[model samples]
Target: MREQPPYLRVADALQQRITSGEWSPGDRLPSRAQLAHEFDVGDNVVRRAQELLITQGALEGRTGSGTYVAEVRPRLTMVRARSREERGGSPFKGDMASLGKHGSWDSRTEAKVPAPADIAARLGIAEGDLCVCTRYEFLADGKPVQLTTSWEPYDLTAGTIVVLPEGGPLAGAGVVDRMASIGITVSRAIEAPEPCHVTDEEAALLGVARGALATTIRRTYFSDDGRAVETADIVIPVALGEIVYEVPINL
Candidate 1:
């Protein structure tokens, strides 16, 4: 077998130090030059190893300060279920409440935005069709945990109180209930989850490194009459949370 890369070896050694309690959370690591001398490798190798550990959430770099062992945070458990809508509130809020964390989100909505081809396809609309687009950053205890971009055909809710998803009397009522208010019942939603790397924009919002491993869920809600009403792309950083699918089995 090929020998492990020098950087990987160094990273393993550094990680062992943390796991063995030699270095505790918030404890600053040795300088790269010092580590390189101790490991008998180039400083570049030590830098790479530290970068790897930073991406893995084992270490963190502070501006003007040295690298340190990162404080371990419990991963948030996000439960996905068809019944979440029936529970009559934001599913994300419920998930956070289960863990005793405060759930909140910041959103920006743009009206009459032209849908791109891919988003159009997901909403079963033609490219260039007007849509209401909203970007959301979900937070747990004021820290971003998830991101979502939602699109819906402008005509579907035009001139209706539900047109602005985050505005009006039904503000934050959620898609399912909001649609129902407009005489359109959302029958089901289909979600396709896939592994993805964080984009620059996602990285900024999620406070993670670009190219970090994440999960993307492509979700489309459909009406009982078989019409696609809304579609959203949900992004969750793997280091911060986990996705759990709960399917009810009827007896």
Candidate 2:
């Protein structure tokens, strides 16, 4: 059998500890030199091991604060819409059923102004449009899992069912679902995924440190007749959650 790379072996050892909860979230990990000595390997090997964990969202390094275990949570799956011909016998179903009950929307207010230029363009709206943004911080297994923000056309969403008791639509049911009830079916959903640094405001709401690694998914929903309806920006802390996508292979 081929020998396993030293760095990978070291990373596996650390990962085992993390998966076993031996090192909890926010717990500092050993320095490179210490890890090197512990594994009887070179410091470079330990550094490589740390890098692996960082990319895997299992660890994070803070400038001057040292490396630490990242909070871990179940990965969230993003399923692309299937074409009509590819739908087969059963149509594609959203996985909201596994996301637990539609919890009460906890109101989180941010005084920040209009949507950024890029976001406004995605929503096909004028720049500097006065918007009321409602945000909800979701939790799973008593840990922060996902942070969601919804931006609506200030005039249209104001004093409507959209701004009901929980503020915004119910959980498990996205903006598209709520809009469809009023004869608006989301025909197109444009999504962009990119790596981002957590801002102070986002960190506070997501319970993560500023500058922490995160995945930002920006989604714009369009009506069946091709009208931009709503736009949402969701940020998932790398450690706390992962975006998973699976594609089947052909025979």
Candidate 3:
């Protein structure tokens, strides 16, 4: 195997400390110059390491301020199509409770008009077909973390448990889990990841500066027979949250 890069080694060192509980959440880390000197590497190398940690949800950096450890832990439990696993049981779990109590929701609202061509294509519906759309902004510790819009066919979603008037059922339970309860298991999830800039409208909703770096994850859920049922577009602040996957090599 190839040797790991210097920056990656640096990231691994920091990751070990975070995982070991040596560096608790909300803790400040060393400055770039300080870390560079400690690791005997250039500042660029240290910066790269920091970037990796941020992407992994291990660290977060304020624009003018210094870097800090993120309070949110990584998810450990395995999630299947039809199971409700408790996230509190794991050390680095992604519990819905982690979203924070003070984190507010502006109340989910339905889409007034037809979805755009792109969204319609993903939902497997016509461009002008009416679709049920709900927009939500998720926050952590009073800071906007994610902006998402979930879409489904109007006929299938209208007045259903999936579209509750207030505090929608899709709030904390997640769409996948809730669907499983209704006998609609998401056997497969297809995600497309791409870099995106915070639009003016999105920035206002997410309470972030315009042009901030973000990751757009368009996820499509399918049943065991490969029938697509729902589509969700999630925009996450690159500096705050991370998308993690735990893949087992031996299936």
Candidate 4:
């Protein structure tokens, strides 16, 4: 068997210390130089180990201070159920409310963006077709929770009252209702969730270490005519929450 990498080995050792209660939550760690000397490893190796721990929520780094054990917080529970969407409004905010946490999201929309090959295929539009892209940062109780990038073909909603997802009179209304307003009935939605590593931008926004484990969901809403009306990629950090899909079985 291949030996564990130096950094990983150090990370495991540090994790063991935390789990064994040698280091309690909120206890600041020794300086990187001290840890390097103690572990007989280079400073870079210790730094990498510390970063790995930070990403796992075992430790947190304070700006200009030092690394400390992270205070435990209840993991968020995110649910994906058909019933939630049927109820209308923002399912995310409702879900958070159900858990007694406030939910809010910040969104920025870019219009007339040329679709990339991948997005074009998903939306069944020609490559370079104009699209409206909206990026969202979702927060729970003012803490970053997830990131989403949504895309809609420009021609689909152009010259309509709901052109901008978060604008117009129907602002903040969900996709199902928004499409219904334009006489398009959204029949179904398909989602593909996959495990991934957090990118630098995602890490910065989610307040986790780079390369942290995460889940990315590629979701698309389809109309009754089998046309894809909207697609979004949502990224959720593993350390922050767990995702649950609730399916209702007809008895």
CA-lDDT, candidates in order: 0.89, 0.66, 0.67, 0.89
TM of each candidate vs. truth: 0.75, 0.56, 0.56, 0.75
Roughly what TM-score does model 2 have, to 2 decimal places?
Answer: 0.56
Candidate 1: tens digits of C-alpha lDDT, residues 79-196: 8987777877677887788789999999999999999999999998999999999999999997778999999999999999999999999988899989999899999999999999
The 10-residue segment of model 4 with minimum total lDDT is 55-64
Q: Write the per-residue lDDT of candidate 2 for residues 45-156, one digit (tens) a residue.
A: 9988887777666776554567889764456553444342143221112233245523233456543358678667876778887565767666554445567786765654
Q: Candidate 4: list runs displaced more than 4 Å.
A: 1-71
Clashes of 3: 0
lDDT score, candidate 4: 0.89
lDDT winner, 3 or 4: 4
Cα RMSD for candidate 4?
A: 5.3
Stretches > 4 Å off in candidate 1: 1-70
| Colliding pairs, model 4 | none
Angstrom error at residue 61, model 2: 17
Q: Per-residue CA lDDT of candidate 4, range 104-175, in tens?
A: 998999999999999999999999999999999898997678999999999999999999999998887888
Per-residue lDDT for 161 in model 1?
A: 99
Worst 10 residues of 2 by lDDT: 84-93
**lDDT score of model 2?**
0.66
Q: Which has the better lDDT: candidate 1, or candidate 3?
A: 1
